[model samples]
Target: MHSGMTDVTFQLRYGSNLTYECSLAADRVVASHLPPPALTDLPARLSEALAAPLEFPALHQAIVPGDNVTIVLERDTPQAGALLAAVWKEIASRGVAPDHLTVLQPASYRSQPPTDPRDALPADVREHVTWKVHEPATEVECAYLASTAAGERIYLAREAVEADFVLTVGELAFDTLLGYRGTSSSLYPGLSTAEALRRSHGQGHDELSPDDQRPLRELTDEIHWLLGGQFSLQVIAADGQNVSAVVAGQADAVLRHGKKLLAETWRFEVPARPELVLVAVEADAGGHHWSQVAAALDAARHIVARDGRIVLLSELEEEATDGILMIRDARTPRDALQPLRQAAPADLIAATQLARTIDWANVYLLSRQDHDLVEDLFMIPLEDENEVDRILDGDEPCAVIGGGQHTLTHLQNR
Candidate 1:
């Protein structure tokens, strides 16, 4: 903002709510803002959704005694404690033995002392069920299946590929590149090797395009077919981890429900573009990744004008993703993208998306990282807290996004 009010304070969402108190002209331009709906009646609502899964057996009827059932979870799944408890209770009521259950994580980079998923289960269930993480880089962990028309080799954990029934429970959100995320994604690209992922991803899709008519639907539907899945439970959230809705059934059906919720709640429509936008990430510790930052930026771009600037409010505690950290040594945005794609090691999606955002607009990062490292990636780093005041002193307009990482922002007119 070129010239604003006397004092201004914004509770920027970074992991937890970070109070961004600034001295703005009292008359600051608050262009547009939108928050998610209330997350009430979650348990009842989830049960209702499961009650009517599209073209699938009831949760209890589908499972039987002595049946080996594999439950896949995305690393990013939230409120997992509740989902795990619900799944176990439902299946147990159906007479399924805990010993017949297996929990697989295809993209989890767990710590040396992996947090036990069993801790979330009941005492009896914990003793019988098995929980394992899959490493896609290792052939022992990932088995090759078929190839897509795009030649994207389909590779997944052997357990999931050979399972009698493949089921997944995770939260699905609108992805800037992939359209909508859910079960099929949790299995295919989420479970595939780094090389396979590179092929699965093509040039970015037009996000502003109507999501319901997008081609990603067909692609995810095909993946659902390949998986031969029993059911996939997708979650919706209001604010952080406040799961409001749960949709289960086939993959495409899950995706459809998730998209519908996104259109109604997560997606925000703004009247016009702004020259300066401040995007912040205030979710959980998991939201510290570069992918989260990229998503926040992707949301901001919809309401940001050409040649405008974006103030990225990310502590970047997770730093750049393992694959994208090399950008810190690169000299320019072009340099970052070329070598990054050629590397194609891991986190290629996030690394590539970030590099593209840097090239798209003037981005100023509000982070705790080394200034030189931030600048190496062609982004301006505001190491000093007072820098925000200087920017606000200007007369230019600005907008603040409290839930940038999770909110689906779009222009109403565009």
Candidate 2:
């Protein structure tokens, strides 16, 4: 139980089955249910999926055997290597020469920085497959038309769009943009020129109302339409540990399958009534944005009690969430409103959606950096480990849920 109005603990649990103790406070709970582990037998699965003889004569004949095929892969994620390897094997067996294959990654965004070289592709595939990286255009300008009427002008990597056949592989996760990311993403945001993407992506940061479709679904659809049927997509949905439950082929089929799977895997059960609840953000998963932290918070709120306390754990790498400037300026929702209103209307809209999703009174964050920033922006205190420990040592009937380091173990002990 919370000793004071502001006091709470963070606990972690996994899949509603296993519980663990974490360094967080006793009243706070964290859920650490990682996506299912990567599917080790992916290659075999891909082989089985492709075993049927080719129906189209055009697909049967390779232009230059195995060496000339072009395969585009998404960046990040531990499963990338396995996914690519499976594609490679499938193509090679179909008579595409190994030397002909080229793997392409989507252009980097300003908000999402590049991955470390160490975490990049393995040497064998790196040596054989040509690599191309695209960055946003420096000189591009953003035009804000309306709530959902922003446009982007990006420079797409020519090789990616020019390929006779482009295969995009990735896991489908809920996104503020395009509803989901996979086939549609690979085409517009993935392969578009930097200028196009910049013009298009700029509006996502604008401030507007929830009813307005400006930054979210509308823009994603616009980008999707612009791709013009240049590439095919393969999307997979994984459990807590990234295990594939559904594999979809073709653009439409893949997207549909991914959406269904997302609905199934992303759901959490909530209690009808409870006095308190705790939530924490995983350092490894959350991308350091308060918005990213908000994603976890949104998941936790679904199951939290009406008057529950939700504590969020985040290592503040940057002041703003999702690279938007206004979010960094204010710590609490009330404090954020002025800056948000002062910003461009589009910016205000995006910020507003974030504000609506989070419960200002119930949220808290524990972080090493910018504790004051979080407090000022979200109205949530930044608590030290000592404070959390003190609360945990006290007597309170607390139920913890959500994810954080050692959170599961802590909950079990409680």
Candidate 3:
């Protein structure tokens, strides 16, 4: 109990009367509050935003009267079914028969099987469209080796490069590797051959820097450029619940709108100084996993007074970018950079960029994983609820933000 207040719970109220509650005793509550909403009311908001008729050039249209158009959906997207429904509605309104469209999803990496594709797509559309499950290529034997005056081995994804028209539907959030995930992400890592992914992942980890052209961004840009040159694209951005506010055409235009919306929704305000900060990662939402780490670090860097402590809470259901799982175990900011630097080539690209750009060392963490590892890497002890109470009692006031498994609560000497 904190300060003799034995029963402590965090209450969140949404849309005036809708409320959700969680016990504060848990390491991560999976629910909390932030100053600004991410895409909280996605369904309602996106329906309203997309209600108007979309305007596309005649040349830009890919679905001809009888053309079989394939829709490539991203796995991490929140509400694939809802988004597909909206797209289908739009397509139908454009006079394209439901039978002319096809639906496809990427294969899963985790033990948990992917959602049934039939459940996500409408029955009518499902009947008409052929469902293709594209797994990442196991053996990428074909590598485009180029030898010029200055020889450099450049490998590209044949399948991704050959797609007729690829439409990417997903949320826009801060990613550890790519500043954001959407658009061309489906091309390189999503549809690209395994070898290309390995090459990109390896190279990204090795040569990644603090610059704008870091591996993830560079690769994303390359895929985007190629896709734009080859085929047409339809990009959508939604609020927290997968409600889309903006539907953009072309690779550049879509990414631009997405970045703007992400900046508005994801950016948080920071007090000049704070003593302690807390961040939580929701267990069910995989998309928010790494983004939560990035967000936790961002918030920690902003509010914590020099030498102040911060805590991160997460279940870590998803793997770390580039497989650098020991980031939580870093003893100091400097100490963390080395292992991140030594990461495999692809992993290094994303990890080094995140290390250089994000300030993570100031924070502590409370999680289900190895607490000692976290302490060794970040040099901050992971605390139980009782320990948190003691720390809160000694220091200043605390403020909490976040929702789902990734929650943030902080105690600061104000």
lDDT of 2: 0.47
Please give each candidate's TM-score: 0.82, 0.65, 0.65
Decoy 1 TM-score against native: 0.82
lDDT of 2 by residue, 19-138 (tens): 334443433433323333346676666545444212212222333353355555565433556556656656656666545666666664534643432223445645656655554353
Tell me how far the alpha carbon of residue 312 in candidate 2 is from the true structure, in angstroms, after superposition: 1.7
lDDT of each: 0.68, 0.47, 0.48
Q: For residues 1-414, write the lDDT of model 1, one tens digit per residue.
A: 223346455554455556565444444454545346545776666676566777676787787766788888766666666677777777788777888888887653333223456677878679889898776677787776666677755667888877777788877877655677677767765576765555665435644454645555456557667767759887876555566577888766777667887787777776667778877665542556676777777777767777688887767756556556766667666577777767764576666667667767788888777787778777889865578656656767667776677777777766
Candidate 2, which ten residues in sequence have the lowest lDDT sum? 405-414
What's the residue-level lDDT of 225 in candidate 3? 62
Write candidate 3's Cα lDDT for 321-396 as tens digits. Answer: 5434545456545466767655553345434433532353355555444556544444455545455455555434
Task: Give lDDT for model 1.
Answer: 0.68
Regions of model 2 farther than 4 Å from truth? 1-68, 95-99, 116-125, 138-156, 202-241, 244-246, 269-275, 283-291, 301-308, 315-328, 331-359, 379-414
- Off by more than 4 A, model 1: 1-10, 21-30, 34-44, 52-57, 108-115, 137-155, 192-195, 201-203, 206-220, 319-331, 383-386
Q: Model 1: which ten-residue window has the lowest total lDDT?
A: 107-116
